[model samples]
Target: MEAKKNPRVDIYRLKNVFFNFGLMISISVVFAVFQYKTYENATVLDLGSLNKTTNEIIEIPPTTQPPPPPPKIQLPKIIEVANEELILEDLDLKLDIEMNEDTKIEQVTFEEDLETEPPEEEADKIFMIVEQDAAPVGGIKAFYAYVGDQLTDNYPTAAARMNIEGVVYIQFVVEKDGSITQVQAVKGIGGGCDELAIEVVKNSPKWNPAKQRGRAVRSRKVIPIRFILRQK
Candidate 1:
């Protein structure tokens, strides 16, 4: 049989509405719980205690200095001196000479002094070029022979070992007395050849002094000495 159902008691028709209302209420509760916040109390500072600070003052002491010393005083000194006496003497002069027209005066003579020493002679000067040049007692050839003889016996061992061969130029001064002086080697090859040449020339015999205007003079002479190494 068909029966009339009560709209209020038929809960099936409102089931959807009940379910949607419950869903909305649950979402609102969940949102409220997530958005909740709690606050803590703030800390307070006491500025009244720090406002009563006192200012401190520092004091400096004064220093006392000693006074400077007084200046020194000096007294003047007095000296006594004796007075000296001066004596005066009288002088007498004679003026009683007489002159006549017949008086004859002897002739006055002024002779030169013969005892005075003559002016000193100047030192002998050396000449580079003279009218006649100095020569050895014998001849130039003879002089060279003498030199060779002197050097042959005492050949420098250094020169021979090194085979040094060259001419050594020797210079010497010939005095006014024809004696050889100031013998020196002007140019030479090394290896003791220069000293040997000088020694040989120094011992040479006297030469004829050079003449300049027929007067003997000191002169300079240069000669070349040959040094050769001989093979055995």
Candidate 2:
């Protein structure tokens, strides 16, 4: 016979042990009992409507409106005519058609006040393009030569530094008395050339006055002068 181990030891030595089966069965039974007790004794709310509702009744008074007035009816207009028997036939209806001799309308006359005003004297006018252009003592070429000479004397220092070169056209008026007036530059190239050109023209000698219709007249003129820089 094999030697027998201790009965307590043999009892505890299970070959295929179900270690947690007892604990699991106990837990499952407790959980099922808890669920059943909860189902049996739970405080369930009916939540069913009691139908206890209060209705608010509002009484609206009838509108106190005034009745509309009746529509207006227009009656037709009637004209009365004179009766045949009541009409007057022999009654004397005379209209005096006579002129009064005392009503006299004399011929009316309006005497106007006569005013005599002295006439205004005619103004002497300056012409833009005269019938005959004004000239220098010589001619246009001579005039340009004179202007060139003047500009050469007073050549602008700035123009020389920048080597500026262009033509400067100047405008002025020749008076009827052979005098130059209102000199100004019409176009310019920069660098003090404009002023220099204007000064040269202003200092020029008087030109022969222009003629219009064979008579001496004041005239306006524009002349161009060249400003050239020569390289040595």
Candidate 3:
């Protein structure tokens, strides 16, 4: 017995069957895949509709710096004065019982301006207006009389007895009213002769008054008195 003949191979039917299976698998895979469209079933938010449609590319403005603030007002500078040392007050001194009770301390201030003037001269007038007083010629005479009366009895035994001739110079002031006030011996001779001479003039009468500027004024005068004792 011969080996059973192998079943007849249907190559065309096998090819047809494989082709149909591939086609069905491709269709099934395509259907199984998810399909999405961005425009499908879009939800529309309601906004107010306008008659015109516009698209604008707006240019943003650049930021600008504001002008610098006005320069700060400059006030004039004030200068401060320097401190000065305090001056102490002088003590109030009172030697007597009389003094002020309410004396207050005071500030010492000095002025910068002062002027000096020239001295004045008055040839006819004295330094101050002082009137002349009458000289005491009467008193001088009384003094002389007293001396003369005393000397008349005592001259012989006096210590001034001399033989030489001598002159005595005396200065006297004659007041404006024809009176003598002061008398002095400007020159004298040794011994009591000078005293005797002065005694004589002091006892003399009042003199005529001198005049200055045509007006009777007191004046100074010098007189010489002589005293001689004879030699025995």
Candidate 4:
């Protein structure tokens, strides 16, 4: 038995053409997916006004103040008075004449005693060098012993801390009455040493007054005080 078919309406004849068309459409879709570009919605800020600069010229008004008033003047008062006549008397001024070589002029003596009593000698005059130099009440060694005893406890803290060692020269006045006066440091190495030396000398016992021409006199004396730090 032979099967009969229509040749013009055959579907199997276009199979290759339909396959190629489907392949080309798949390739175009893949290319379009890879090359796709998307736009984003962004807002831009306007900063042109912030970047612009303007210079302004301002005017300041001057202050207006009134001047101060002048000082008030005072006028003197006038008074009325009665007129009076003045009477003046004549005076006689005659000096007696007495002038001769042997007329014996009496000596004029002052009732208030104008002799001026020789200026009552200056009491505070101090002598630099005297016949006898002033000495401490005890001998020099004993005086130094007392000073050493006092200074053992009176060492300056600053001087001790820094190990400061030096001699302080002090000048003082010995009065006529065996009293010490005007004790001062002539030269010193600082650090509270000068002041401490002055204090110790001021508290020392009175010294034997100096003598000049067999009379007790005020005199100046200079002494050196050594500050030595001992090892602990």
Error of 1 at 206 (Å): 0.4
Which residue pairs come into collision in candidate 3? none
Please identify which of the two predictions, 3 or 4, would achieve the higher TM-score against the true structure: 4
Model 4 has an lDDT value of: 0.87
Candidate 3 scores a C-alpha RMSD against the true structure in Å of 43.1
lDDT of 4 by residue, 144-171 (tens): 8987877678888999998898999999
Which lDDT tens digits does candidate 1 get at residues 134-228?
99998899998998887788889988988888999999999988898999888989799999999888888999999876778899999999987
Better of 1 and 2 by lDDT: 1
What TM-scores do the predictions have?
0.48, 0.46, 0.33, 0.48
| Candidate 3 stretches greater than 4 Å from native | 1-160
User: Across residues 44-97, which tens digit of lDDT does each residue of candidate 3 receive?
Assistant: 888877789788989999999999999999999999989999875896867676
lDDT of 2 at 191: 91
lDDT of each: 0.87, 0.82, 0.61, 0.87
Stretches of model 4 off by over 4 angstroms after superposition: 1-121
Which digits, one per residue and each the tens of the lDDT, describe model 2 over residues 1-232?
Answer: 8997777777566644666777788899999988884336679888998788898999999999898998888888898988767687989987875669877777998886567444432346778877888998788788788887877777888999999999988898998888889999999897999998888888787789988767778888888879987665
TM-score of 1: 0.48
